[model samples]
Target: MKYSSILFAAALVFLAAGAAAAKVPAGLDRIEHIVVIYLENRSFDNLYALFPGADGPSARTRWAPQQDRTGKVYDLLPPVPDQRFPAALINAPFLIDQYVPQDAKTPDLVHRFYQNQLQINGGRNDRFAAWSDAGGLVMGFYDGRTTKLWAYAKKYTLADHFFQGAFGGSFLNHFWLVCACTPKYDDAPEAIRAKLDDQGQLISDGAITPDGFAVNTIQSRFQPHAASVTDEARLLPPVDLPTIGDSLSDKGISWAWYSGGWDDALAGKPAPSFQFHHQPFAYFSRYGDGSDERRLHLKDEAELYAAIAANRLPAVSFYKPLGIENQHPGYANITNGDNRAADLIDKIMQSRSWKSTLVIVTYDENGGFWDHVPPPKGDRWGPGTRVPALFISPFARKGYVDHTPYDTTSILKLIELRFKLKPLGSRDARAKAPLGALMLESK
Candidate 1:
């Protein structure tokens, strides 16, 4: 057997053993709702370097040292000025604590699919700077002491080993979050297909280039409207993949994907900040425009707040904030996203459903940020770079750290097991369910 196939088979065995060993918590059925608040960009180390008891980068802990293009380690990283706001950078990875003030945004880094693979560099993890557009900034870390979300982590369950499911950017990872599989464009046009070299690295401008890693970000030929043609590559064609949403519906379990600025974006409003690619359900056939499933399952963020207030949240809910509040570098700052998330958590806690709710706060992908730990060996797609995942519930072990390894598909696994739904038959089937000591009480 091929090496990768052997590894995959071994992984499946491990997952099966893990599932068999973990008994479903007795009171899991009492947890009637699962709320997934998905933020954007930032990696675990980028935002939680100081999170207590978590495996994070530090002078003593594993350090994410920067490397130049030539693979030489940089004693001190050079300044990476934002393309839009070149003057904002402070020349190095400065401590972004409460004392530093938090109005400005950092420049965005390249988090495309191929670039991530290059950064991972077969688990060497020393090529972040050599493969990045943001130079040494790829090795940056933040002080968790400044953030409200960090406080939430300290007060709740932080899964130190949680990772983004796929190996790419927000678009594909969002699909992984719901579907646990890569979106496919059968017989895609040559223009859209990534050009790869002998070693499988992306080829661009007649040469293999690390900077030309656009594996799946091409514009879709099918646009929502005429004006949407401006960036067709960004929109993926509608897919027919079955999602966790479909599974929930099959079991008659209530669910919704609440996204910020959904209505305006569908209306063809320019830069609506709705982020079309971020809406994974919108690209699925069942939830296509004008479909009844779309109307019932997809909603606006405002509706989420209303639902919380009215205590009418569904059994499964996924919330995506607007661009400015998403904590994505280049446009949004971490402070804004952290504060908004903290407030949202506060509101959720205030709701009557808090006692029965298990809220998961996580990110879509690493967003080109540096993390010291290498991702686990899974399939060709991933268990990508480590991202922060917080389990917030009345039953969650308070002030505890969960070291159990989990990918984005793990969320789907938990939901599937809890609702007695069939597996999606991809990573979700083999992924470890969030079981064991994560909960404080059984019954």
Candidate 2:
């Protein structure tokens, strides 16, 4: 009895001591600045699955039966259909064989749909009859993968178990990432309201139409802007409901968003938010106001040093990339390993800003990739399907691989918790709380 009692006491002491040794991650400090650089779609393993045992607790998890079986749209197949891909290296059957996955390792319609994103990746392959393995595993035609992100993983913190909120495609998931909720599908106005039911839940369904908000409407708009301003014309309506932007602004902290230029066409994805950040960046460029709320812009990471050297660092700054760096498979740079996304993140870490700054790096969605987790929330869009979340700052614990399930709202939640600020909206306010492991008790 005495020995067991002694062991328990020792364990408690060790636990307390370990917690004392760890410091809070920089993002959760007074956390003056917050910058989220969302990359294109990708899951942790698909990108880092090859991380050579770098896979986390959830890596082994794969697709299987779930209540999600109700979402199958393949049953409504038409006799003839559009070409499966804008460009594919193999015939539909073979392409599906290579990419579209099946349950129990068999050949069937279900497997094909699961393999290449049938509904979300939309298209019919009734005509093209040829199988070519020129490209690689995924369709023979789409050949793009990069080594940059892996290199970045070597340098910074990588959150392996982070997840996307729910199922479906990028549209609703990205909306939730930004606003924490998709306002009743396609509610036209694209607004977020404050309301809670008995559940105190904020996430809603992806029902956009003339009656529901279509995926394109939410996914494309980059500017709270209009066509007259720059490229792709469709602008994301300005969100007044608080975001990480409002959180930092409230603390008299400075923040900036740096984006690679996109005129307008691609506003829905990473493009729109980049422009919104630039609106503030334009303010600092013209007025040269270096006080609180100073925002700036740059097309690439090359200019970051001068800005940091000039001591023009904002409390939080977001770096958006263009061209080869964005990591879109469409960019066709992946296999060749030109991870402009990974390198830019590495570059930011090399800066003096990294010391006190908490860099929140993640992707907008899985970008038609596959992950094993059945997302924990709504059926609309979600927690972007388990991409990696990297935290690189003085406060970040080295070699810390956390398995905590976090989503976009966790970003807002942590900031609000750290600063004693109000939650951004219903989803974040009511969603499950973020793991407090990143935080250290203030002295």
Candidate 3:
């Protein structure tokens, strides 16, 4: 058959399958509120490798071997450097479950955009240690048995095949979660542009090398507070990107991005633990500091708690925890973050809106952790690595594991479908909604 005919056949098969799978469960329309609680940096295998029924790492599973910059496999993984820990004390790809206590912290690895591509290495997935600043620690895994969220997975719907929308750290993936598009800076100052080497890695000194990928971390030019002086170049300038919020508002639907420490951070308070880049809406002109949109939609996480108590939750909500509550390596540990998230869930369950709400719990990125499964083919930004996602609702299928191919944009797709809103006209336009086999009642 001609190539065009083959494509047409595939399209037909896809449409038929979708029609078969798409079921508007009874009472789905009664779900008036959708809450998305986005956590920080963890791969699915890193957190849910032993999840009861999810596709996670196993002893029988073939491990992706670590590769060196020279394309040679490491006989033994190297210790993460630039830390107080002795080189001999640490080894790459070690069972973190054995060493790090459930409450103890681990070193943060490099999960930057370019470095992740190097680690992915055209899907060989063997260069994690070679390209990461945290060395073999990049290959670490955890015991899900000790985590609270793991228990929650057994109670709700866990999606094992979900991936991060973009191939980068919290900064970019957060953008993908809210906007389903990468933030761009036109005419960026030469001083702040990522300097790259011939190998497409960011050069030691921050300049764009010829024909090299600008994958290194750069500072945002437009930070929330001018007094903050750390990693200024890492910030991206404010862009008028279209976001899910924009879409909802355009249709007169109510929504909010409730971020931890947002109010304190905007006030320039010290140690609010607010990450500027993590707040994607702040970068958009529509939600600038003094705008009515900012006041109405960009809210503190406390507001969400209050809304839950008052039974005034909006049609859509996205909640981001503060640094200490976010389950990020190096600065924070898994146990505390898991417990915090569980507490939030417990509160939601007790709230008045629980019966009419659908809660989605997921991470922003893999946080430089290793996973055995490769992400599906996607556009330039990503479908980076597998991350755990949970669908929690009164109507959600109990004790279920969803294997649908989804990414961060999938959340946006769900919101679009739920609100009958137009697409964001990016990857979200084509992203699959995680609605299959999740609801209790079927057509």
Q: Candidate 2: deviation at residue 158, Å?
A: 2.5
Candidate 1's C-alpha runs over 4 A off are 1-25, 82-100, 205-215, 218-226, 230-235, 270-272, 440-443
Q: Candidate 2: what lDDT?
A: 0.43
Model 1 accuracy (lDDT, Cα): 0.74
Off by over 4 Å in 2: 1-27, 30-33, 52-148, 151-156, 165-174, 183-207, 210-214, 218-240, 262-306, 335-338, 378-381, 430-443
Compose the digit string of candidate 3's lDDT tens values, residues 35-56.
9889989998888887876786
State TM-scores per candidate. 0.87, 0.58, 0.87
Q: Point out the worst 10-residue segment of candidate 1 by lDDT.
A: 205-214
Q: lDDT for every model?
A: 0.74, 0.43, 0.75
Q: Superpose all Cα atoms of candidate 1 onto the true structure and report the RMSD in Å to 1 decimal.
A: 4.8
lDDT of 1 by residue, 131-180 (tens): 77776667667776767888778888888899999886887788788977
Q: Which ten residues in a row have the lowest lDDT in candidate 2?
A: 104-113
Ranking by TM-score: 3, 1, 2
